[model samples]
Target: MCGGPSAVVQVVHVTSLRINNYGYLERMVPASPSTWMATFTRVVAQAAAGFRRSRRLFHPWGECFAGTITLLVPGTLGIREEYPCLVRLSKGLGFVGAVPDALGLAIRIERPQPWDVLMVSSAGTGVLGRLIITPSALWTRPCYSTLMPYQRADGELMWLHARALGGHTVSVRRNALTEAIKGAPLGFELLSGASNGAVHWVGELTLERTAEPGLSFDPGVNQVEYLRLYPGWLTAIRSSAYLGSRQSRGATLSD
Candidate 1:
């Protein structure tokens, strides 16, 4: 009886307004799990039909190449070792030939440690700018980023960056990126730091694309040594989306 009948009427009115607001939102954004799944299926079929539609929600290019990643400097746990790896180059969206789409590079390291690094092309540095830059700035010479932050040896937060060596361009197929990395060995370096901070080289990665296929790559599969995945809402959404995609593709997460 905080406010008696008058209070109850006010509460009812407030509830009605909230319900109406939700109804409006529902009309504006008809988002649902089933809707998302349907979209995924459609994209897959489109890509299969050679329509240039990407199966992945983001970074859908399916062409993967194998390589080796070597720690040039001591990384987390002071370990300097070489790990067999696979790198997948893709477009963020399922856009048709030569159309603008975010570019991506996903790396999976096996043996000695099993972890995945997903990088997206960006122009500016820092947390906010990283998300703002589109795929237009991507090429073989420019750097790609993981977007998520990692913890450094000294406990400082850092972002990961990868760049092609010898001034080579990692352009898209029909453009030049595919040809550039097709034959001869391509070299890349992994660096750590903030968008505007001092950059530190963590390792060197080489791609050959001649290795046989073995294991699948997923960032949510295993834990990386010192690299920390970004925390909170966005990370949670990303993890769920990744798991869903893997499951749909019949990929398993190892223990």
Candidate 2:
């Protein structure tokens, strides 16, 4: 599944291969069109042989790997138009899955579970974060029956929190939350638990529909307020201070 304005999703997959260098001799023997065609045939044969051997030995999840690569390089496929270059690349690389339906566009890799990657994207936007789910989870839980959509203060669709991060509180439009429930048949329940030692979801929320802008809340307030605009920018400064303090203590112990 993908998200966004339905205009940015694209996915592509390529296989990995290895080749031996037969440098001077091979180069000197391949100057004509027929020779080049023969060289291409040989390369394909070798790649196929390698793929067979590797599949038997490691059996690396090619689908997962291709999906990961698609997230990293969405525009590599022509989600908007035909991308012959990507098509050729996939063929040459020996991909063994369905041809990418969309042109390569911007995609994000959503991390849902430890070992699984779920692909989500808006209609046209490339894939979003990879949401990985275990096979057992798939069997036990309903998939895509319900989705959570987050909205910005201006009532615009923002990020969707498919899974909760340990220390992050997602701020979303109240109406959007209700809409998500109504749009999907899955039963909805508010999250109530401790995250990062802080109590979350302490009260019932009433959903309202209006044009008014929502309030944005900042959960973390470090002393360096001047650098608030740049989130995580002062991490290095904090780390340095912490290390220096430890060093001073170590010197004192030595003395």
Best by TM-score: 1
All models: lDDT?
0.61, 0.22
User: Which model scores highest in lDDT?
Assistant: 1
lDDT of candidate 1 over 1-255, digit per residue (tens)? 676565534223211221122323112244455445433443343334354343344555545677899875443476688888877767666555666667777788886567788888776445665555466533564468777776655667777788788866454654355456675778888877674666777898888764333234556445466656766345555665665555444445441
In candidate 2, stretches whose alpha carbon ends up further than 4 angstroms from where it belongs are: 1-49, 52-133, 136-255
In candidate 1, position 200 carries an lDDT of 72
* Residue 21 of model 2, lDDT score: 64
Clashes of 2: 34
TM-score of each: 0.67, 0.15
RMSD after CA superposition, every candidate: 9.3, 25.2
* Tens digit of per-residue lDDT, candidate 2, span 1-255: 265455755432111212346422222332343333334444544444454633211111111011121111222343321111000000112223432221111111222211111112122111232122211111112111101222223333322212212232211222322343344321211221111222222111111221122111111221112112122434333333333332322222111
